[model samples]
Target chain A: MDQFDSVVQLLDSNGSVVANSQFTSTLSQSELLGFYRDMVLVRTLDEQATALQRQGELGLWAPLLGQEAAQIGSARAMQKQDFAFSTYREHGVAWCRGVDPVDMLRFWRGTMHQGWDANHYRDYGYQIIIGAHALHATGYAMGAQLAGRVGSGEAEKDQAVMAYFGDGAMSEGDVNEAFVFAASYQAPVVFFCQNNQWAISEPTRRQSRTPLAQRAVGFGIPGIRVDGNDVIACYEVTEHALHRARSGQGPTLIEAVTYRMGAHTTSDDPTKYQLFSDVELWRERDPIKRLKIYLQTKGILSAELETQLAGEASALAQRMRDECRELPDPKPSSMFDHVYADTDINLEKQRAEVEAILIQSMEN
Target chain B: MAQLSIVHAINQGLRRAMDSDSKILLMGEDIGKLGGVFRVTDGLQKDFGEERVIDSPLAESGIVGTAIGLALYGYRPVVEIQFDGFVFPAFDQIVVQLARMRYRSAGALTLPITIRMPYGGGIGSVEHHSESPEAYFAATPGLRVITCADSNDAYWMIQQAIASDDPVIFLEPKRRYWQKGEVNIEANMSDALNMYSAKVLTQGSDCTVIGYGPTVATCLQAARFAADDGVKLEVIDLRSLSPIDMSTLVESVNKTGRAVLVHEAPGTGGIGGELAARLSQACFYKLEAPVMRVTGYDVPYPPSRIEDDYLPDAERILDAVEKSMNY
Candidate 1:
């Protein structure tokens, strides 16, 4: 109960606001409702993507069923100028960053290498290599500091970076190196970890003896453990961390205690190792249901508002389904298009050779 | 014009690159106050200040990974891995992130990062210090692998590599760092051979010998010895390993009808094999015999006591040349 005992919670599992949290004054009712809508929309997108994978439309799907609050809350807390580097499982964060839902399916559909332009969204696309982008984010933050775009008094002008990884990434050398550089340089970056219990069947405890947040203390970084299922709690912690980073206080490691409610991906069968009781236990702490209960208790979730939110979610899911099904196969020659900034001489030679082979095949 | 060692030439080149572009940065372990393990970045931190010339932590992967980020942020970071063998720790970042980022982003982003490592086996100090890891990098796409054998090329190519938009793996012959030569500071890149082109250091009609990095000097020495034996061996310095100057090599092999590939790295699966295969294919009809290679044996770099035998020297190159000429 050391750090987790002090876990910041604005809303509990009972759908009642904790008497002491400051979000009651900071967040407006409309903003609270927006969080609920985003969670529902992202969850719907996740479900639709899973179904599409099952129907052989996608290569695989990594469901974000139980960690919506952690992703959406931190993402919504970010300003447009701030950059985010996320893992492959961060569909909710991508949604909050205003990425088109259909674009998210491009990688799994094998339609494109990356789903979207990182520069356009100010969000680096999902990094498949575990913990590599954590170093990238730290370097970007350091560059921001050196460029005078961060640590300035003006909040809007000071761009910070959020590097999101799972609990499993903590074990990677790149992540540890990122921690060292971020701490030593005091870079304007936040290491956001969604400790969703399992890293494809390996539990968080297997990676660490102490809490994940406590590991940051060894790096001389401030650490915070928050209930990742609590949207307000995640938002508050992330907001405070982002502020600290922008103001030149250095990096903070925030561990969001969450769970994955589905299989690791469409390719995995979690029942082989995970217990049913554990899954049922986390079902009680469903982030979406708890938020809906709070909205209903506050009388802000009217029948018409619920219908509108449900309609919006359905529309998003339908669009994802349609776009995924319509994604065309990439042109064969396009494979050599972007291996380098300028086409390499060898690649150019190979491209011409492949083109000649195709021409011959067509002629034959 | 000044007489400078390959190490000093590189230091001057780094200074010139940073002076020309404020975005150019130098980072590595002990590069700042300690200059570097080889002093290639010596006095750079003093002249440019610490911000531009950084002293990174001991982690090789961190240096490369963060350099990628810095590149994204518009800084052309030139990272140094202290030695050749130590680079494997950063192999993931170099192979996966550095080589694939530009392609993965579909040309939206470019990593103008130059990774400098003192490579090759000659000065046998200990394990990990003496190694030739160029073939691994040459095999990777989206990366440009180049090595400089002389001070003149070292003074210019380091700057050129830093200026390229694509990521460049710049390998320096650690053993030849102190070899001195005349460097014309005012000379432009056009005055020298292009970074990717192979230059014929010595021309002969009897046989063609190809080498890069430290082995280029050995091949030159072998040509000198072969000349004494009345066997004229044409020596070609392969500046770029990947996307090799095959046209030049093919033309030379076509004329000579015999070729010998030389390097300090192991013979099996080495850059020599690639050169041998390409030369064989390109000069199939013109070849007097199969292309031969003189390289280190297929084993881990041995102890310093017998490094002379393990490394390809003038005798080995001449022996391979004699075999090619006889065949």
Candidate 2:
């Protein structure tokens, strides 16, 4: 209805396009197949992680069961120099960024401070405080804009950022403040909200009266609602948004209308609140399945290639399951290391006390 | 040396830092147009333009969180958390993100962020305005906490604080913001006393009275009053609260065997307790008394009329000195 005139096509659950778009030619059969494979791999990893927690291997797991396309598609669309800030539920995006899926267990298992090395992937560590990273993305974008990093002629010279959060994060005071700051500064960044409808117990309806994307209009940035399960839709939207940012057009908020097909975390039981039928309805719209069907219909995927991909994905999942089970719990004294860079008397004293306790426990 | 207030001193430090580093930024509520409630950040927005001096929304957490991003991008952001009471809202961002960012990155990333909070009581304002929250940060790991007793210390210490590569929680004594002193504007910022070392403001043979921020003035006054009573009191200003200036404290406690620690924060788990424990270990042999303390009672800072009772006054400090001397 808005800007990307022919861009917002709603692909039906049966792999038939109910509406069409001019950007369809922008994607090739190989890219479409690649996106599907990534989604399937992520979904497989999410399932394995959930089972790992249930089997007492991990302390917790945030299953990105349904929002795989929104994360993987957008993550693959960006240039390497462009940075990313993600909330806790961006495992799929982390996978696209080349973060070891097993490393994420280190944080949930309380074995490490963060999932992976931040600089390794330019993935600024996963933020637990909802929407706090949104502002960081805004600030970094403003910094990039100032250094003449935006519209630098060379594609590598243009740097923008993408901030990912959920519907629950939209209600946070910091997220709204990020909107204000981004708008005022006209910082080149994309505020990507995977509106998966539930903030633990609360739904998206409770967080916003209008749609989450519509709120971006108030910030003077363009907003769009995309078919989140549609991998092509997510990639096209994110790529175009990044282009606008690099062109110094400022921020854009994309509300990927997806669904959470699994529990919020290993500790949460969605059965306590949400209806099971809703999950079933969304499962039919599984991002991987739609893409697979589209690929199969287009004769882009052969049974042999699909079997090989699934086998590889399954083997990777098994290795993750095995590695997570054998992963060592952190040494108790290591907790003091990250508290401060310089030696602190109070922390040293506390560490000594903790060491004494842990040693005593070991003797028992 | 031109005389300037602590407010002006901090203003000079900010101006100098911004002039030195193009990446240095100043942000907070009313820090832009209205300067600041205390005018410590006054004239910054006008001098540096809006990008360098930002007037943010009323959310403290947002200010600190975004500041972390700015720091990650190689900008040194100096934030003003209007008052002590308002710091709690940003405690999550400051402690969890800003404080932990450097360590989380394993020294790969630098968070040269300075959080300037106008702290301590005594300006006779409404509730939540005059509270001593330094101990909270002092207990928090990964944060370097520091405060100044006077304008000279404020001018040099603030620049030193901003220049540090680590995140610093800089506490400004609101009550003493208007106190005037000689601040050599031309003096090298790092030439003053070491940031981690405490200073012996006054020397005496009787007892050591330790305090910082607004309480340093009160402690000095108490020392003077004690002198009238024939009690020669030594005063120590703890400039750095976290990596505490223990050497100066140990030296003084050993010289003056009897010691009295003072602060406006509650008596329990106060900086006084931490100092007492350290000095106890460091100067146990020289002690003439089980170190005494004069501090606010373990209760919320009360109304202005009752704040006299809640905050340790010079009389109470002298009383503690007498008690320690008696022991």
C-alpha lDDT of residue A183 in model 2 = 92
For model 2 chain A, where is the 10-residue window of minimal lDDT? A1-10
RMSD of 2: 18.0
For candidate 2, lDDT tens digit of each residue in A1-364?
A: 5453232544556787555543453777788888888888888888888887787666567788889989988888888888899987898888888898788776655555575888789788667666889999999999999899998778889988999998877867888889999999889999999989877645677567878888998889898887788788888889989999988989999889889888876656667557888988998988888878878898889999989998989898988988887667555455456545678776566457446655755796
What's model 2's TM-score?
0.56
Per-candidate clashes, comma-separated:
0, 0
Off by over 4 Å in 2: A1-7, A18-22, A349-364, B1-327
Model 1 alpha-carbon miss at residue A197, Å: 1.0
Deviation (Å) of A44 in candidate 1: 0.7
- Report the C-alpha displacement of residue A180, candidate 2, in angstroms: 1.6
TM-score of each: 0.57, 0.56
Predicted candidate 2 versus true structure: per-residue lDDT over B156-233, tens digit per residue: 888888999988999999888989999888777657877778999999999999998889999999988988889899
Candidate 1 lDDT tens digits, A1-364: 4754576678888787886543443778899999999999889999999999889887677899899999998998899999999988999999999999898888766566577999999889877666889999999999999999877889789988999999877877889999999999999999999999876655676567888899999999999888899998898889989998998898999999999999877766677547899999899988988989988988988999999988988888888888888877665455556656875776566457446646755796
Listed per prediction, chain B TM-scores read 0.98, 0.98
